[model samples]
Target: MVDRPLSLYCLLLPSQKMIHRLLTTAVRGLSANYRDVIYYRVKGGERLCRTPFAVFQERESGKLSPKARAAMSPEALRKQFEALSGKKRATYAAAARKNRCEIDLRRKAFKQASLSGFSHFIKTTRQWTDLGRRAKEKCCAETEKIRQAAKVERDKMVEMYYSGNAVKH
Candidate 1:
């Protein structure tokens, strides 16, 4: 007969109750199986480290350290925001708004310019044909519209940048 531990036997034919008991003992640092326990040496004394199951349980319980909790709190966030000087905050806000507006305008222009579905095939053919002419005209009109909107947004963003203020404040 092979001299395997009882824990190995329990693993081979695991029931819910046996598995639970095994995990409980492992978490409490009392399991005879070396694989189930983690050891830590501190100040010449051996301490039991957390098993995977215990770590999983702690994560599942949503228990965070005090520092982590405080960092994520609304009051802490407000304090961080208030730490910046008003003039610097305004300058940052204006720049952010300008960048956001420019990005949105560019995205809109890209979407308008990209040919979708049958438009790709229609636009690529000879422009002298009636179908091709119509498609070309429609594409040109859309492009013109996007260019005009971008110009307007550019002017607005420039004004905001020079003034050092966003639309909201």
Candidate 2:
């Protein structure tokens, strides 16, 4: 059987019991996304991540370990690296703040005009409010009308049954 795909938002839902995350790569040391995780369950509620949850696990590396490396020569290591060609072994070179700012400025404008401005926001919000009110009013009116019609039909049915105006068919 195939396991259903779990949504990121589904993890935080009210009654969901379990949440699982697949380990892509377990980066070592303390970065922004690496921390010890703990889970807990409430008596009346659901199981939740209780502690700091940075995704971490023992990462299975492609290259062989140092103890296993004693038999292999320099050529073998080079061949292994070549085999694992695309995996990045180091962090990116962080550009200076000044350079970053300059690049940002060159790439895009500082201020941007939106398709929907302040007036549009007000209009849209008012329209939503109006639409909700209209829908509520319409539902109430229709339900009341339906109830009244049902009552009238029921009264007619009773009269017909009593007056011998209808058969079982």
Candidate 3:
């Protein structure tokens, strides 16, 4: 049997067991590269299939259909936004603000963690006191500042959402 790279379409068989069966029977004596491709393609296809909408789309057009494209366009989105009631618009804005705040907080925390490298050292030594007073205090102060900012943002988001007010910025 001639060894050829498997098509992605072949891996899209209805059942995973079918792919496994094909691999076991047809992939024997194949080069390591071919086996690896089959393994990864099957795994990747399985991952894609987990999302039903994506699987349906793939089975249909393998790309966004015209209706999907139109629905996702900027003008369509603006029209959809315009159609929402005032209260719903405020709620959506609040949710977006909250999401942005959370992402910013996570980024700040990650930056602080990387800069301090204190967590790694603490984990290894199991001794917080091993860090010098100045470094320890600085790290604590920075972390506190980030926490306070996040709390303030969260409170503001909740207030705006409940009050049905749009942020003026």
RMSD of each: 26.8, 27.8, 21.0
State TM-scores per candidate. Answer: 0.27, 0.20, 0.31
Give the lowest summed-lDDT range of ten residues in model 3. Answer: 39-48
- lDDT against the true structure, each candidate: 0.43, 0.31, 0.45
Clashes in candidate 3: how many? 0
TM-score leader? 3
Candidate 1 vs candidate 3, TM-score winner: 3
The sequence of per-residue lDDT tens digits that candidate 3 reaches over residues 1-169 is: 2233365334434563354345434543545533322222232232122232333333434356778765575555566567768886666566456545544553344333333334433333434444588877876676566556656654554454445454333
Kindly indicate the candidate among 2 and 3 with the higher TM-score. 3
lDDT, candidate 1, residue 98?
53
lDDT of 2 by residue, 1-169 (tens): 1143344324333432221111112332442211111111112221121111110001212245767656766566556544552423221111123334432432222111111222222223322122466664654565455456545654443344345454321
Least lDDT summed over 10 consecutive residues: which range in candidate 2?
A: 49-58
Better of 1 and 2 by TM-score: 1
Regions of model 1 farther than 4 Å from truth: 1-72, 115-169
**Model 2 alpha-carbon miss at residue 165, Å:** 2.9
